[model samples]
Target: MSQSVHMSVLLDEVLTALGDIKDKLVVDGTFGAGGYTRAFLEHGARVIGFDRDARVKPYVDAVSAEFPDSFQWINRPFSEMAEGLADVGVEAVDAVVLDIGVSSMQLDEAERGFSFMRDGPLDMRMSIDGRSAADIVNEDSAEDIAHVIWLYGEERKSRGIAAAIVRRRAEQKFERTLDLAEVVERALGGRRGAPVHPATRTFQGLRIAVNDELGELERALEVSEAVIKTGGVLAVVTFHSLEDRIVKNFFAERCGKLPSGSRYAPEVKAANDPTYELVTHKAQGPSDAELARNPRSRSAKLRAGRRTAAATWSEQTVSGKPSTNKVRS
Candidate 1:
């Protein structure tokens, strides 16, 4: 197969965390251009790769042809891996690795509508089904739109942006990426020489809400706990603070690092034995060499854990106090 142009961030660190996986089962939860899956196969590991984007089929075909016996591809979201794995007669895997958020392939293709830098249909659905970003902006109420932008994008001026969208849509509904991006940019009073684009956060919010990215990540993390064998690894590379926070909290909770209540409040104890031991005390970021090679990886953070022999926690006991502290970039 031809080489992939898409770069897998923190590839060396992820491989190191997984240790020796030769002949072991590993799930590449976000296959993308088959970068990680190819690496795993090269290491002599058997891989089950999952991706929701149909556009990745060509890459999948190439990897399958080369590693016919060792590679398998599932064209569903990684959150459904447990059910997908059961259908393939696999009970558990030795490790599960996820590269979260939108893939570079989607971002680069203007037609995918993932980037404000390029104009395209306002479609950001990862599965190519369900609600599109155009649908949200054109049909949702101003209040609802503001909430989505604020909650998912973390944009401080979400209200003004939402109001601008509503006012503009009243004249003509938004159908193109540039039309909406322009509105958001104007709403924010132009870039004002900011390093990042004015519409970055607004686009991010719409994309997350459209794709249900956070919900999918949460479900995948939970399912992974059940499908990994004892001593198995669960490694995730997050691109932003929101994604990193979820991963950090999940690892902390599973590793028995439950949050202690305030001095006036009672301390909480784990109802079940810890399910994992943290592979790293703190999250790992890209090395200086990697940053120089791929500046896009600057925000990437990798967190991993090794499964313990303890039984998986019940739903009631699985809840963890959401971390109030912001994740350091």
Candidate 2:
């Protein structure tokens, strides 16, 4: 994973946070290009790595050749780990590390349609199946499209973009990534002096929607909570605010950091005792040195928690607040 990952952000911070897994088994939840798993293996921990992309098979095979008995690769979404790992005779893991959102490998491959930098089919599924971004653009209602762009991308001009997409698609359906990107840029008034390309947020939103990324992330965190043993570490590295916000709130809720709210809307407290202690009270960013080495990590944020001996929270107790939209830690 490190071979393709090139650099892992907050590498020192994550290793230090996990303490010494040593001989314990660790789950590399995302396995993107293998950065975390490589580090975990090097540190003497057995790794159970998960990923949906078949492109990682070569990297997984290479690691397997070297580590033999210590590494296992599961070609599935990280969200499936709870039941999947249990089925394989593993109930709990020493630590779980998730590097959320699209990987550098995916983004760089124009054929994957994760980026509009080079023209390619608008197919953004991490797996071979599922509805493609082109499908949504060509099939979804403008209002629905607007909702996805607004909610997932947090784009203020989503409605106009959706309208433009609709008008253009009526004449000729979007097929190429750059075609949609150009339409969005025009809809947003040709970028002006913006630092990033005009289509970045829309592409991000589409990718998230196409892959059900937020839902997958929510599930992965919940599953990790169930499978990490007492005193086990759960570290998450998120690239954007959407992922960071959920992680922060989950950590806050699990660590008893959130206060009981108003009488009308009281705080979501755990019926069981607090399940985790904050390994990171606030999100950690890439250090100056890391940023210098890999500028792509500039937006990365890492948050971690150490599980307690107490019981995990029930789903009903966590229903009081919207975990996805809660205040960040």
Candidate 3:
């Protein structure tokens, strides 16, 4: 595979949050293009990079050639980092950094079908396996499609867009990115000078639903708690509101920042000790200079926390309520 150019978002901020890493074992959970891994290796840290996309082999090979003794690649999702690391006789790491969402390389590759601007096969699977965006658009019911767009995309015209997709697919199955984009655009009244494309949310919803991106992030957050040693940092960079919310909530709950119940009820204390301390009280955004250099980093937000010596909580004890935002399979 040819090398694809990808600039890691908030590279400096993430490094600052991680502090010094000389001789530390760091895990680059989302090792897209090896951007963060390369930086970590260069700073005298042994890096274990994880990515599900097979196309990243070239970048992995390049990193391995440069730092053969300090770099290792795992062909798996970041959520499964615990198992992958255990397979190599590793237990915990000094730090874990996750750059969430689809990479720029995936969006630029027309064949990946991550962008509506470029026409190609309607496939958006990061792993290049399982269901694709075309499968969801062409096979799911109108109501199901609307739920995905509404819940994941946060689009208001989801029902109309889904209805339009179903109507178009009857005459011809949706097989291309531009075909679906056009259908959504027409359904939303041709954008009418909107700041962003009409199909952007719909595409985002489909991509998230196809890969269970939100679910994977939640799992990764939980696993990071177990795999990161005490005092190790867990830095997450989210690109959208949904992702940022999950990360924020996870940090709040883990840091013993839970909400009080009700005025009628007596005050209840946290069941378990805090597992992490907030590295930053608020999420960090890109600077003006960085924003001008990369417009795509505008929506990026970085939130991090350092693990404590407390015991890890069980999944059930961590949160009283189950997640309802997950897309139905």
Candidate 4:
């Protein structure tokens, strides 16, 4: 497959992790290009896919025609999968697979403003509606922008970039992707020895904030816990550390593995039952062949788990709010 396309990252690992989904109902949480869903359908599983992007309808329509009664597409965010699926008489699914982060298609289409590589309108709304990147850069205070950059992108020079953005926007609002990118790059001292583009982190932070990606992932994990049947499987592929960390921590929490608090604190059993068992003890990375085939999959990590008979932790799935500005100490 051409690397230019949305080549499914860790497709083999995901299929292996899912074991046998034949004749089972599976949920593709992020059906960007329908890679995972198509694979599941070919494996004899009925698929219910979810995506906020309406542009994916044509691609999904073709797959739906092939599968006929075996496939269904829900044009909604994965966070609302539980409620949305319920409306269509899908109470639970046997497996849930999510491929997280900005899609290849979104990045390639400069009009979406997801990539800093090409100049485009500064509109990075995942759902095609809501607060945009331009809104944040133009309206939010420098402090707020810095907080988002530091929290989402883990950029050390977030303050400098935010300050520069505020200064530049005062003259003319950042209406284009290249305008913001250039400002951020200049703030970071023209890249110097940086491995990636200087504006990559800034663009990533803006995109995450504009789409509320972290919040969506956090809420979606809870929804997966609620909607997946006992013995069901959950396979997630995340592109970066921030996304991987959430999945790792969520799996740890659900498996009854308590975090090591201070030495002063004693270990106590969880009040609720453990809802998931570890499928892969640790996250799986793309293989050498996959790397050669698609360099973009370099940072991808796949983590999978199996649901237990224990009740869902409906009230307390995550530690705090979904869209947290929590800076890791």
> Tens-digit lDDT track for model 2 on 1-329?
44844566678889988999899889998887787788999999999999999888977888889899999988889999987797778888889999889988888889998897888999999999889999999999999999999999999999999999999999999999999999999999997899899999899999999999999999998888878888899999999999998998888778775645565766776544577899987899998988888889999999999987654565335664323211111
Residue 285 CA displacement from its true place in model 4, Å:
0.5
Candidate 1 residues 205-282, lDDT tens each?
Answer: 999999999999999998998888888999999999999999998887888766664767654656667888998779
Clashing pairs in 3: none
Worst 10 residues of 2 by lDDT: 320-329
Off by over 4 Å in 2: 1-5, 259-269, 315-329
lDDT, candidate 1, residue 324? 17
**Candidate 3, residues 1-329: lDDT per residue as tens digits?**
33335888999999999999999999999988888898888889999999999898888999999999999999999999989999998888999999999999899999999999999999999997899999999899999999999999999989999999999999999899999999999999897999999999999999999999999999999889888888899999999999999999888788876655566775444566777899989999999998988899999999999988766766425565322211111
User: Per-residue CA lDDT of candidate 4, range 174-267, in tens?
Assistant: 8999888899889988978888999988888888999999999999998898888878899999999999999998898888776556668765
The parts of candidate 1 lying over 4 Å away from their true place are: 1-4, 261-268, 315-329
**lDDT (C-alpha, whole model) for all candidates:** 0.89, 0.87, 0.89, 0.87
> Model 1: how large is the Cα RMSD against the reference?
5.5
Candidate 3 Cα outliers beyond 4 Å, as residue runs: 1-4, 260-269, 315-329
The TM-score, computed over Cα atoms with residue i paired to residue i, of candidate 1 is 0.93
Q: Which has the higher TM-score value, candidate number 1 or candidate number 3?
A: 1
- Strongest candidate by TM-score: 1
